[model samples]
Target: MSTVNTTPHTPGPLLRMSDIRKEFPGVRALDRVSLDVAHGSVHALMGENGAGKSTLMKVLSGVHPAGSYTGSVEVDGEPRAFADVAAAERAGIAIIHQELALIPQLSISENVLLGHEETRYGVIDWGATHSRARELLLRIGLDENPALPVSALSIGAQQLVEIAKALAKNVRLLVLDEPTSALNETESERLLELLLDLRDQGVACVLISHKLGEVMRVSDEITILRDGRTVETLTVERDAEGRPSVEEDRVIRGMVGRDLDQRYPEGEGTIGPVRFEVRDWTVDHPTQVGRRVVDGADLDIRTGEVVGLAGLMGAGRTEFAMNLFGRSYGRYVRGSLSRDGEELRVGDVADAIAAGVAYVPEDRKSLGLVLDDDIRHNTTMAALGRISTRGVIDPGLETVEARWMSEHMRVRSHGVDQTVRTLSGGNQQKVVLGKWMFTRPELLILDEPTRGIDVGAKYEIYLIVRRLAAEGACVLLISSELPELLGMCDRVYAMCEGRITGEVAGADADQETLMRLMTRTGEKK
Candidate 1:
């Protein structure tokens, strides 16, 4: 175990991590990584998906414990060691992970003070709990009632509750990991504003995000990490009017080790006759009676064409996709799905797979892959029959198929036997894509495919999508980013309130034009 010298307090950065080294059984996750976060500033960490950002943060937050890694942590220029998460919290450090830690069934107040509840005579003090939670909520500009269950709030609101939970410990140095990956545009903007407010209050924030525009907007300094080491930390240059002047390409160079001349790859495929079509697709909400989740949505994808679905969070894009695939989401009310001009019946997931249709879900962690399983099992899961004989599996064939998929998908891993849960977010996503692609579908629907991955990984996925289209497959891409839609799709369809509002060629579409159609509730102008 390494030790830090007992240094006296002095004026310096609020937090400093020097020469952090973390290792797993087969990998050195971090190597000599260092970071310094000044007080009253937003320091952004930018990197590729497996670039050791999260590992370094875990060491600092005591999730890895003091003796588990070789590092020296300093607060107020005084060397200190954190034994565990609680010890780090007591030192005014709080971490809000990308996947929120709030309990959905509990009330906001209960979740905020979960471990350190207020007590009166050895009993939980309900009044003090709600009072303190309300104060913290107010500080973050959240106006919701603290007594409401966390499940009743939107994802954006739940994110605010997570911040409130951190504030309950009187956090001075806050760390947020990919905070806006799941949020809509409006929700993401509000959260960015809150971070700026926190900076104004002299709170030191370490923000880990892949959105370059968002980082440039709120970050005072940016640190770039690549392949388990620090590339460099550049101070964000500002113009005379107090606007960020740093080029996004510089950050990209640092992350990927070279300039990314183009973010989305160009496709050479030409569109043909309609290969997949859906008409009058109406689906009712499963839990709510007399309410339609997808209302008479109609669309068609031509062969070798990449189509985009643009909408807000609740526009039923995912529901429509899920229902079309296998009626997996909402209750199917009425719809007609056809392939090659022949009407098809997709009663369940198996039937959908047999009908040459595949869907990659939006929430990959819960609905896509089995985390505990190894890469080989997950890769061949959707198409096990191919590698089996007489209902008996062939281990050699399975290994061969899994290895091919991993190589084709560019999945970074130790081997096919590596557990899927231990891989990084980008690699796990590759496995999910590989599992679906192994089924060899004609019409592939990708929902939020690049939601939380880094730019380098995103570019790789985009190239894969183009390759699939070039191989004469029809693709329906659902994403919240309008730029992504414009960059990749041949045509775009806008959905509003469960209905298809408008359509435009991708070359002719812009953010404003799509936003107008996405918010439309009446006849299109």
Candidate 2:
């Protein structure tokens, strides 16, 4: 049996990646990148979307085989070559991707022991697997039965399952790519605690995240990547001694390549008369129809008004908006919606469009985009019927519209023909926004609008949101980030346990108050 050698005061670098290089067809994904992570320290990789953060983690985990890139990776003072993921796993390297790699139909125990299932004389050992999975769950502060189907679990619970899977691998080094991207405050904190526990157990972790605040909170060292190159590697402590003053600021500057005066921009303007309103609205959960996700809700947005929906992960904020939009996402939805003082029959997404409404869903990769198609195709998907003539599609019109949006939104791409899948998360989100924006709707519903976006891209989206509101278009912003909502929205509605617990004007809203309402459990007002 092998044991990991790790401690806060342990000597030498446990892993060093030197002059790493990887190139995709037309893009240089990684170029001469170098980063060093020490045992027992949480090293954070920070960068804007497509800044090659995930690529580096993949390389280390052998997702991109050792031969696929130009680099030298030394673990425990010895050079190594990992032919594939299995080899990497054998070498104590384990990575959990941003998008979870779990099969919904599989049981929790099955997911934990997927690749290396327990067996006795070529027979599946279900009893042993369940016990092992249960043990791993305990390490993650969970006590759920291993036999439960993964589909029965919520996204947050599923994340814990992934963590357990990593533990099953006897990992000495762990890599988490945007682990908290979809997590709410409580879930995020819990996940962080588990990582700390693992670190205490002598495991090293590499955290890749765009959330700078959380990154700053947990990271022992920081590495910034830019345009596939390693800009700098920042060591938080020097030989177990804290760095000098201004070290944090120095790290932030390196990550962004400039000093960002603000984390979120503050803007104010006139919020004009009731453009959209929802009264006595309710939406039930998808699986549990009898249980209401949103009990009864009331919301209003005036022309040029930016209304923010603030809540925890299960606060029912998204459910309320989704059910009212076009009835496209929820089940057993009963809602009354009005637009411009007239009743709106939002039966489905198309009906919502007819009422001058547009929705940008939260999941861009799955629901918001056509992965195999080019950007031009995805940009015009929502309004294809409008762009088409008598059921015969007009490629010329689509191309023209796509080109205009690509330039207008400042989407970075080789051309409109570039595959949407190849673009960065932020750029893909822009495509989602562009598709809905091009329709020229009177009211826009943005769900987590700036999520997973870098500081520079977030600034651009903020400007876009402000511009839209300034143009007398109603904006409904739904986000988990309290700072963003408070900074941009004209008014904020705080939801808790599927109801609007409180509503506050933007001028008076703050993290403390919003969070108070967001986490409140009981009959929501």
Best by TM-score: 1
Residue runs of model 1 more than 4 Å from their true location after superposition: 1-9
lDDT of 2 by residue, 1-525 (tens): 123344233357778899999998788999999988888778899887788998888888888997899989988777978889998988888999888999999999999999778889998899998988887888788779999999998777899899789878878889998898888778889888877777777788999887776776678888899888899777654444533322555656776688878755555566778988888898888887588888888889988888999988778877877887787656845668888778888888888887889888888888888989999989888778867999988999989999999888889888899999889888998888898888888989999988877777787788888888888999999998887888888899888888888888989999999888877778456
Off by over 4 Å in 2: 1-11, 237-249, 286-290, 331-334, 519-525
Tens-place lDDT per residue, model 1, 1-525, is 011112233578989999988888888889899999988789999899999998888888888899899979998887878899998999888888989998999999999899878999999999998998888888888998999999999999999999889878878888999999989888899999989888887777999999999999999999999999999999997888867878899899999998889999999888899998989999999999988888998899999999999999899999999999899988999989999889998999999999999999999999999999999999999888999999999999999999999999999888999999989899999999999999999999999999999999999999999999999999999999889999999999999989999999988999999999999985432
List clash counts for every candidate, in order.
Answer: 0, 0
Local lDDT at 267 for model 1: 90
- Of the candidates shown, which would achieve the greatest lDDT relative to the real structure? 1
> In order, what lDDT does every prediction score?
0.91, 0.84
Point out the worst 10-residue segment of candidate 2 by lDDT.
Answer: 1-10
Report clash pairs, candidate 1: none
